[model samples]
Each structure stands twice: as structure tokens, then as C-alpha cells.
Target: MARRIKVLQLHPDYNIKAHDFADLGEQIFRALPPARFETVNAFLRGRPTGDQPESRAERSIYFEFSDAQLKGMRIRAMWQLFRYCRSQRFDVVICNRFKPVNMMLMLNRWLKIPLCIGIAHGFGEYDRAYRRQQTARLVSPAWRFVGVSPAVRQYLLDCRCGFTERNTVAITNAIDIVQAEGLQLSRDEARSQLGLEPHVRLVGALGRLVPVKGHIHLIRAFAQIAGAHPDAQLAIIGAGREHDRLLREVELLGLQGRVHLLGFRENALRYVRAFDIWAMPSLAEGLGLALLEGMSGRLPVIASDVPAMLPLIQGAGGIAVAPADVEGLSRALDEYLSLSDEQLQMKGEQSYRYLTERHDIEVFRQQYLELIDSALSEVTL
Candidate 1:
């Protein structure tokens, strides 16, 4: 048999749970057939803490760099990473996020890896002049840049930072519908665990409580309709610095009891079944994974009218309201609250159908496999 192609998958940091970030790194490793590929996963800034599940790659390495070390020039980290790559003679390096991608681009000038693929998760990665100029200067034929969403790909193209039609592509993120559904608790159990009454109509959101997530807008929107829909309640799941301010907002709106801030639930996907309707009022997203997770639970969705989420919301037959527009969000909530039980269930079925048909995990895996094959084939030619 020919020698197995050695691949290195680099991520900036390790997640607390194996399930976060949609397990994309492991999914990529599994895409390459074991007989033909040897995979290694490297975390640039985190080390395993007792009993935490690690990457599923054949091997895993943690550099354990600090925040200050990773910032600025990152010369020391780059030198260490370069030495590691050279010693291992990796045939392909897949860099996830900006820091890993930037460092590899500079190092590959000497390391000369056969193939280097860089993935960008969201916007504004190359917004700074120096970042763009340096990227344009160092990019080579061996490098391929992937945007996690079509909108992100367009952002890269518009930046004119050496990412062109030939070197850039978009691969929309995906989730395993079956796996996600299997993880979900039954509606009654989920509600009970979440301290939600079974009879209450619930509007739910799952994300960090950051301004970019637009949670405040959702809270204000729900407040608008609270008096009209006495049976409906709003619940947001996740934690962030905005917790105290958001709690104050809740109090100011006189929605203290009606709105629930379910902070940072582990395996939040399991509780999605507790929602009557799922809402993601994010001001921006690189393909809202939470919205897809909600769909996997067969919940009807309401999402902001942003590029990353518009197609998913429209395809799923869900409502789309303008980002940060409390009035519009309020109207959208009222529309869902008015629906009959049969109508609501049908809406949810549409979301599930859209997810299974459009964002299937199998399709995502095949796309990555094909992209890798194409890159390797180009090298041979």
C-alpha cells in the first residue's frame, strides 16, 4: 500500500465539551478514510483538564499557549508550530479560525506543506489593513481559504485580500439531524427540567448573552406581546457578561416572571423540545447552528433577516424579522402566537424537513472529502 497521507488539523482553542463547535474537527478527520489518511489534531492554546473528552483524531497535541503569547506577532508560537510541522512532514494542514490560519500562512513559506486549508467562521477577520495586506502578501497556490457561509465567502472576495474565486469557497455549516434529535429530551421532561410549566407557550433562544446575539431585542419584542398572550413565556439559554444588564431590562419591562433567563445549560440542545417556537435574533451569524439545532428538534423558528440565517429561515417556512427591530420581532412573535396547534406543528415539520434535506451531516462530510480530494489531485497534476 502507498504511504498514508499525514493531515494536521489545527484549532485555536479547545472547547469545554466535545459537542460544541458542532464537532467539526472530528468530522473532518472522519471524512478521510483511515486506511488512506493519518490525522492529528492540535490545539494552540488549551490543554486537557481531568477527564475532559479530547479530539477524536488519531493523535492530539496541545501547545498550551497563553492569551498574551497568542497575541501580536506570535513569533514564538509560530516558530514552535513550524518546527513541529517540519518534523512531522504533514502533507496537509487544515487551520480553523484566523490565528491558526495566519500563522500557518507565514510558516508555510518555509515549511512548504503540500496543501494548507484555512477556514474562516465569521466576518471581519480581514477588516484591518495590515491583516489584509499581510494575508495578500503571504498567500500562495498551496493555500485554500474556506468561508463557513456564503455571505462570509462574499466578504472575503470583496476584501480583495488575495482570496479569489480559485482559492476560496463556501461550505455552509451543518448538523446531524438524527444525532441532534436523539439528544433532545421529550417535551414534558425538557420543560420540567427547565422549570417551565407544561401548559405555557414558550419562545426560546440559545446563545451567549452578548450584544451581537441580539438577546435584548428578543426580550423587548417578547415584552411587547406579553400582555396579549398571557399563556406565552420567553426563555433564553446561555450566559455572558450581559446577564445583570439583561436582568435589569427584564425587570424594567415588568416581565420578571414571564421571561426566563436559563443561564448556560449543558447540552442545551436537549432542552429545545421545551420550546413552542425557537427564536434567534442574532445581529449576525456564520450560519446559525443553534437555529439548525432548533429545527432538528422539530421546532418552528423565528430568526433575524441576516444573510447567514435568511435562507434557513425562509426554506424552513419560519418567520424572519429585521435584526434589532423590536417592533418587527414583536409582530413576528404575535404571528406565531396566533397560530392554531395544528398550524404550529405543521410549521415545525417544515423546519425539520428543511434541515434534513438541506443541511444533512452526510452531505457536509462528503463535501469536505471532495474538497480534500480535489486539493490533493491538483498537487499530483
Candidate 2:
């Protein structure tokens, strides 16, 4: 019998509630081939707050460290990772963040693992000079750096950030179409459940209430056009530190009734049908998975024209506005509101077609498998 490949996936955290990193990790975990691979998921931090639901895939190994230990957590995590690798003898170490990449590289100096893959989920991962320097120092021919978007891959090369053209590759983020479809709720029913009037034209945005998400800008933009379109309402979902501040802004703008701040719903994507249009005004984004989820629901999108988002929205029946520009966002919202019902339906159809053609989870899983296979072949040769 052929030897089964042993794989280990490293992550900073595995909070299922959070989007982006955790979502990507979960998708990969579910897609990894069980027949030919033995996989284990490991995290540097302990279990997240709130209920920790059991995952369907392999059980995770968390390296619980206290606050003081966290000060030098990277080093401690590195030592723990090295020990684990040594005992388990994993054929491939997939590092989900730069810190883990650094750790594996340092370990490779002695152990020489068969394959090492680093995944860059967003542009911010390598923004600092020290990070770039570390990447430059640790990068090797044996290692492959995967970017979640073309813009991200190009940014790494253009910025002269440690990653070379030969070593870097882009793989667009994807959504589980089946799961998203399953979560779908009819527009009227969804609106009714959320206490929103079915007659009102709703604009929806879902993400954490963090500053970088640009929720404040979205609210400001809605404030500019609320009076002009009194029938239109804005719904911002998800919870974070910015919740109270957002409430204050809503009150200040006298939009208490028009703008609804629906804090963190477990199945927020199901409410997509309630929205006439989806809005994402993030100041910075990796690939805007929420935008993809919105598209899956066949809703026209209005997103910031950042590098990470531009390619995803362009020519997909969506409009792109300058990040943090309230005026631009308001205008886009107004334009969408002006369109006839038929035009809106056509645009939504276009978005659905684009999503089905380009961002399927099956394609993402295959790409990852191919990359792994290619790396293994190189080592064998």
C-alpha cells in the first residue's frame, strides 16, 4: 500500500463565529481528502469565548497559553509546534499565517519537512517592514506562498515584499454554494422575522462592527440619502467594539428608525433575500467573503474599490466606490434605488451567474489538492 500523506494545518485561532481566517480554515478542513491524507488542525490560542460547537472534521489541538505567556507567545508556540512536528512527522505543514510560516521555516533548518505552504489570506499580513524582512529571510524554493486573491498576489510581488513571482500564486476565495443556498429564506418571511417592514426597500451589510469594516462610513452614507429616499432602510449586522459608537451616530443623524443595527445573527446570510442591494464599504478587505455570500443570494453589491474587492465586484453587476467616501457610497445606493424592478432583477441574476462560474468551493478544494500534489512530486524527483 502507498504511504498516506500526513498534513498539519496551523492557525492563530479557530473561532467559528469569526469570518475570514476561521471561515477559510474551516472550509479547507472540510475539503481535505480523507482517503489519502491524515490531517490535524492546531491553534496557538485556546478555545474562544461562548459555546464551542464540535467540528465535523478532525478534533483541534489548542495550545492554551495565559496572558503573560502570550507576551512571548510566538516563541512558545514555535517550540510547541516543533515538538509536535517531530513526534508526528507530518509530510506537509500548512501555515495559515505569517507567524506560523516563520516558525516552520525555523524548524525546517533542522528537520527539513517535505513540504511547507504559507497562506496569505489578506494584504495586511505583510504590510510591515519587519514582516517583509522576516518573509525574505525565511522564504525558500521548497516553500510556496498562496494569496487568496490576484490583487493580493500582485501586491506581494509589486511591493518587493519577500515573495517572488515564482514562489507566489493566487487562489480566489470561495463560498459553500450548497450551504448558502440551504440557509436561504424568502424575502418577505426573512423581513418579517427580523421585524422589518416588507414594503420598505432595504440595503443590507453583514460583518463585524470593527472600524476597518467601515460601518461608520456606511451609516454616514445612508444618512446623506435617507431623507431623499424615505422608503429605503439600511440594515447593518454583526457585533464588535464599534456597536455603541454606531448607535450614537444613528441617534445623532436622527436615523434611529430608518437604520437598524442588528447585532450578530448566527445565520445572518439567510437574511440576504430581505435586502434589495448589498453594501460593503470596508476600508480594507482580503477578498470580502461577505460580498461573495451576498452575490450567492443573487443581490447586487456596492463595495469599496480597494485592491482586494475591485476584481471581485467589477463586471459582476456590482458598483465599486472609494473606500471611506460617504458621498460616493450614497450616490451608488441612490443609483441602485433608482433602477426599475426589472433592471434590479437582471443585475441580481448576473451576480449569481458570475458567482457560479468563478467562485465555487469545489474549485478551491481542487486547486489546493493540486498544489499539494505538485509540491510532493517535486520532493520525490
Candidate 3:
């Protein structure tokens, strides 16, 4: 077998154990044979916190360092990598995301022969501009870049960030559905496991509880639905600073009993199938991976009318409402709540059909493989 390229994936922290959208670099790199990508986590004041992973991937490592610590052992980690690159043995170096791109770029002066590539998963045009300008200064010596969405790719291209359109490809967000076998559990079974009543209409949202997720809007919309359907309950998975604020809003709206906050379920997709309606009202996203997972679980979604969600909702699978419009969101939920079980199943099936055809794991894997293969050829030149 041929030797595989070596990659280094960087991230700040593993939020809710998602390994972050930034960690998509390592996920794709792991799929390539004999190729090893180690995860390097940069914590603010100390080591990153979380339970250690039980997965088969032993190559992953998280480093917590202060400015003082960055000078000691962390310096050695970079020096060691530099020396390894100088051996002229590895095929390439993939520097994942851009938090410390400048440091990586500055230190690659030690690289003897291997090429450097970047994986950028920016969400919006403004953010892309802000990040790329910062990245150019630190300049990790990456010869190519990959993004997860066309919107992201366009953002880079518009800025003329020194990457040719051909060199900046779209690989998209992906997950291994097979790993979560019980993730596709039947609605009744999942509801039973969670002790959910059979009669309650559940409108569910999943993702980190960040402001960008627009959970506040979902809560506002659900408050209206709760007004109409007292038997309806809004359930959200994922935890963050926004939790208490969201709960406070629920109470202020007098929806403490009607709205249930289920924080960060490990099997998010499994719990999704139990939902009467899956809602994604994100203000922005590179692409909604959680929404993809929700669709795969046969859940009909009512999402925001952003570039990323338009394709998913335009098909028969779900509804798309104006962003940040509570009334529109409430109206969509009200209509969904009135749907018969058979009608809901049909919409869910439609979502499944569209997602399987356009956004399945195999499609994502091949796209990633092709990106790497093409980048290797360019780097060889």
C-alpha cells in the first residue's frame, strides 16, 4: 500500500463533543488510508475540558497551554513537527481551520518537501473576509484550501484571497450514520426511552445553544405555538450560555411547563425522530449538518430561509420562513401542528429522498476524496 499524507487538525475546543465544524478537516483526513491526522486543541487559559473519547481514533490529542506554556512544551510540539516535515518523507501537511494559521505558516520554514493545505469552514461573507485577512498575516504556508459550502467558497473568491477557484473546493459537512445505529429508532421507541407522553406535539431543535443558532427565535415562535396548542412542547438539544436565557424567556412567556429544554443529547438524531416537527432557524451557517441529520431521521423541518436551508426546504421535505421573523416561524409551526400523522410522514419521506440524493455521506466522502486527490496533483507541480 502507498504511504498516506499526514495532516494536523486544529481547534479551540470540542463544544458538546461535536469536535466543532472546524474538525471536519480531521474527519475527511481520517477517511483517507494510511493517512493520520492528529487533533491539536488550543484552550484559552488551560487544557480543554471534556471526557476523553472512547472511539478507535487514538491519534487525537488536545493541548491546553497558556502564553507561558506556549513557550515551553507547545514550542517543542511545533519543533518536533517541523523536524519531522524536514525529513522529506511525508506526502503533505493539512493545517485544519485558521485559529493559529499564522503560527503554523511561520513555522513551516522547516518543511523540506511536503505541501501545506488548509480547510476553512467559514459561515458568512463578513466572517470569511474578517478571517481570511487575519489568516494572510500569519500565513500558514498552505498551497490549497477547502470549504464546506458554496457560499464559503464564493466568499473566499470574492475577496481574492490568493486561492484560485479551482484550488478552493467545496467538500461539505458530513457524519457517519452507521456509527449511530440506534439513531434511526422508531418514533414510539425513542419517545418511550425519553419518557415523552404520546399526546404532546414536540417541536425540536438541535445544535450548540449559541446565538447564531437563533434558538431565541425558535423559542419565540414556539411561544406562539404554545399559545395556540397548549399540548405542544418545544424541545431543544445542546447546551451553552444561551440555555438560561432561553429558559428565562420560556418562563417570561409563561411556557415553563409547555416548553422543555433537553440539553445536548448524545444521540441527537435518534431523539429527532421522536419530534413532531424539526425546526432550524439559524441566522447563518456554512451548512446545517444537524438539519441534514434531522432529515435523515425522517423528520420534517421548518427552517430559516437562508442560502444553506433553501435547497432542503424548497423540496417537499419542509417549510422555509423569513429569517428572524417570529410571526412567519409561528405560522409555519401552527400549520405543521395541524398536519395529520400521515401527512407528516409524507413530508418526512420527501426530506429523506432529497437528502439521500443530494447530501448523503457517500457523496460527501467522494467529494472530499476528489478534493484531496486534486490538491495533491497541484501541490506536486
Candidates' C-alpha lDDT = 0.90, 0.83, 0.66
Clashing pairs in 1: none
Q: Which is the better candidate, 1 or 3, if ranked by lDDT?
A: 1
lDDT computed for candidate 2: 0.83
Candidate 1 RMSD computed on C-alpha atoms after optimal superposition onto the true structure: 1.2
Task: Score candidate 2 by TM-score against the native.
Answer: 0.93
Which window of ten consecutive residues has the lowest lDDT sum in model 3? Answer: 36-45
Q: Residue 150: error of model 1 in Å? A: 0.9
Residues 227-343, candidate 1: write the lDDT tens digits: 999999999999999899899999999998899999999889999999989999999988888999999888899999898889889999999998999999999999999998889
Q: Write down the lDDT that model 1 would get.
A: 0.90
lDDT of 3 by residue, 232-258 (tens): 888888999899999899889988767
- The residue-level lDDT of candidate 1 at 122 comes to 91
Q: Record all residue pairs in model 2 with backbone atoms less than 3 Å apart, i.e. clashing.
A: none
Better of 2 and 3 by lDDT: 2
Top-scoring candidate (TM-score): 1
Model 3 / residue 19 / CA error / Å:
11
Residue runs of model 3 more than 4 Å from their true location after superposition: 1-4, 7-26, 35-51, 54-58, 61-63, 67-89, 124-142, 379-381
